[model samples]
Target: MVRENPTASLASLASGQSFALTGGTVILEDGSQSASDIIVGADGRVVAVEPFLDTSSCGACVDIAGMLVTPGFLDAHQHLDKTGVLRFTPNPSGTLQGAREAFAKYARTAGPDDIHKRATRTVERCLSRGTTAIRSHINVDKDAGFHGIETLAGVRDAEKDRITLQLVAFMTPHPGQDFDWLGKNIDGAVALADAVGGTPAVSEDPPRYLDILFSAAVKAGKPVDLHLDEHLNAGVHLLDAALDRVERFDMRGRTVFSHISVLSALPRRDFQRIAQRMLDLDVGAVTLPAANLYLQGRDYEMLPPRGLTRVAELHRMGVTIATASDNIQDPFVPTGSGDMLEIARWTLLAGHLRGDELSAAHHMITTAPARLMGLGKDYGLKAGARADFVVTDCIDTDTLVAGGPDRAFVFSKGRLVSQTATETIREKEDA
Candidate 1:
């Protein structure tokens, strides 16, 4: 039985100081929850995770009985540059093309200060909800003209102490501009960002667009994250083309495909074939259910299909898959709170995952995305890993992933960065 300790206080630990959190249920890498004590070293790395630890030498010891401790959530795919613009730019049609046009108009006049302020607010909201790291795709095109990349890089540096922000120079296509413009600007944007990304499906020539993106990533020694085949037209899909480029550029284990919703329209055999190729190439996939479900299947009047990729099938095929909040309160999504657990829940329902697979859903927001972001062994709740964790009142992984807890404590490198608790009031009625 788990014990309840409502009076337990979470003390902040500075850098170069050791701390211990005891009597908590920790979610391990293998999707199991165990009662353990997490010992954070003086260097802000986990020294040990055992059933009990010697806290005599630690500077602070906190008892967190009946709480669930897990690695901080990782949002592998997001659009920080386009977030929080619902008031100014609303997608009246609620379609993908409408959103693109809306955001393009907004970007034409948006300054660096506007982009920085909006992105910084989103980062704070994400951190308060237990997201320690985010991989945001900022638009890099003729309309935006590198403003998003320059502004977000500053935000990444400013928020380095509280959150880890990875920027992807999203090479977007615009009218009246040819591939030459993208080619000339991609290298410079990739130099300033952590990865190279683009929306190949929206380009006039998908193959050529993908080639430019892959070449830039290869030249810069960076990973490629692409918005691949987001529509439901399987006949006009580009997954195979992207896979061919993945092999041609030798980007194995360094390429991620986001929002390949076309997979939902393919037959089982065809999807299996593509899945096998992805596994062989060590390519990763991310499903943006929030944006896809809202933006796709709008033309169909009845029995509209869920616009997510084949998440359960991909997992069965042993493909490294993750889910993320693609857009937040913007024209693309128009609804999001920067909460990763909410994203996990959407994946659980829209991805057709069973109730028993809640642990797998939890991994979509944690370990799966971490691996896609190339965090490999540096993340998680293991010894020698960075001491980034989220403590919640939920007792197990299922409870945590279902809807999340009302109270949460976020720690980055063993330092308490954000904490939230919701209070409820009820009226008593006379019987």
Candidate 2:
């Protein structure tokens, strides 16, 4: 399970006692920076995080110099299984419907081996970019079948120690309502995946469809994450219906909704009413700015909606929200480099988070996503937390949100997982 990179150092960094990362600026949860030392025990957990530390008892003292360290970034939502198929399955129309039909057609011939290869490559890229964890949704339907589930499981097992990976068994609620195939395996998918996902927004009846999804989650005893009303001017918000199920099933704090972009389409009063309900019911939300902006308002001619949710307002209303990359190089979204910092940067722009709020924008990718994923208190830049973090050239929140440079080093469980060497290409001579 420990995948040792051929180019990585053969000599293991694991040792007895502890080690200290000295001389780097550590960014705390509060967005404040301090020149500090972080001590990692041999077991790969933080034993001390402070401005100063005595490193006399450590096995190694890694000098990170001017680098800044922050908790490893997390993609609370992504599509690992479908990454890297952009060229083969281009969406000429560049609309959501086109993507659905195109991907479904290509999937018929794409076998398990194909899915594994693409998913693993994406996992590696995400790790290289300082993301230590990911929650991916693999399509599960009559079209893709359970093969996507097995493919996701294989990639996660193969890279077990390098990062945290969770799967969401995703089946869009439409497309022939193939209940015979889906109904037979829906519960099985839930049992296999870390969470269950579906788009009730596309179903014939939204509220009733949510109840069905909820019943499945309760039966499988897994949490739920759904794609709800991603289209703009959607008449009804399934978010309201989801709340009814939460109360009916007592499934508080165990539900999440992604791409609820229709919240932007709601009237201000209605938006606040639903926002208050989201806070009261303890439901979490994830905004996929890249795909949302790309697909949502294509039909409109002038002044189309931004396709972004009210991120700033959601944060202000005490609702748990995180920004994530929903698709990477797939038909639904033609572009995404698998960088969480870039996703955060887009959230700042598309979601209108600027100025002093940049700190919270950074949180949308790191801290907020970590908490929404329920990684617990042991997952951030804190004492006794998991020794998963990245060292980059950017120092403060502003530069971090801007995503100016690549990460210099990535560490997981107190061991070096990835390291980068910078080289600038010389520009061509003057004409």
Candidate 3:
């Protein structure tokens, strides 16, 4: 029997009590949507999800009939430390090196309070747009040191109730610092972070740099997320070096490669071989189309490449692939809104993802990133998973991914975190 409470309200469910979100088209594990009722327990976890869950024991039943319910979006790769600093650190050249130089200059005087303020604001923006989990990479070098890591840790603690934040100790190279400096400071940074990461392509010696990162991760039993070959120069690549390190450290299934933009320049055969290697090792990939498209291909005059990884090829090959907003309103890419759906749209257009593959594109921001972040067993619509989800008027995945709906209800741990709605009106035209 179906039971509906006439006087129930969605806002009432935020009181940390038992509730049932009934009559919604819930996105299932395989990216399919079905009309289902999600029963959330008093402890703020999903109790059951079925066509008609027994909500007789629930305190409130809010019907979301005609709405689309999906797991909260996840961003697997982002630079929170550098977000929202466009005005303070302008990249006039609008190139990758220029951004790095601008940020390095700013980092000389950047304090924890400033970093915390900017990062917290970005987190709020991401949460309002339905991102409940984020894995942000913080730079750790002689120039930036531990300011970013410490400040983001504070942000994570303060926003624990609203979002899940994982920090990466991104070991970067500085001109004044040698490999010995990284080797000396990496373990401490890794100790303070949830994962270890670095840009191996920019290091003086790629192999030695990767060895230090992998060795630290192995010692700490932490996951590895690397910014690998984030350029168009296919002649100079580091995928082989990184793969060898993954194999040496036995980091299979716990490693992720972000922004492999160079892969698009490789021939089909070479791309296929590398893709197979990634699959065999259970390594994941995250494509940051927004940053890659902006920073790469600037040296070309005509027929410049899309400057994105082969997202379609990797997806077709059954590799664990995802997309993210790498740098938001920073020197790296000065335009951003902290919205994952916007990232999805960019991926669709730049990566040549067909309209028929909307579900796959949707997964790039939701399930695919969730899997890459190792959000295992507790990040879905199934029973016992965390009741973190977004409610929108879009009826299916295609409508949700093509362009997000104007209105959305974001819930974290069964608590209403954000509710956004937009209304537009224009003068009536002559009929």
lDDT of every model, 2 decimals: 0.90, 0.82, 0.89
The TM-score ranking, best first, is 3, 1, 2
TM-score for predicted model 1 compared with the true structure? 0.96
Between 1 and 2, whose TM-score is larger? 1
Tens-digit lDDT track for model 2 on 1-431? Answer: 11323222212455444778777789887667888889899888899888668987888666665678888989999988788898889798998888888888888788999998888888888898889999998888877888888888877877767898989989666556765666678888887788888988777767656777788888888888888788887576677788888888877899898988999998899989888888888999999999999998888999988898899899878898999999999999989888888888888888987677888887888888887788887688788888899877677667877755554678887777787756779989999
Segments of candidate 3 deviating more than 4 angstroms: 1-8, 426-431
TM-score against truth, every candidate: 0.96, 0.92, 0.96
**Candidate 3 per-residue lDDT over residues 1-431, each given as its tens digit:** 23343222564455678888889899998888899999988888899999988888988788888789989999888999999999999888888889999999998789999998899999999998999999999999988989999899888888887899999999987555598888888999998899999988777777878889999999999999999999988788888888888898999999999999999998888889899999999999999998898998889999888899999989989999999999999999889888899899899889998989989989999999989898888899999889899988787899998878877888998888888877798999999
Top of the candidates by lDDT: 1
List the pairs of residues colliding in candidate 3. none
**Model 1 C-alpha lDDT per residue in residues 209-321, reported as the tens digit of each score:** 88899999999999999999999997889899999999999999999999999999998899999999999999999999999999999999999989999999998789999
Give the Cα error of residue 216 in candidate 1, in Å: 0.7
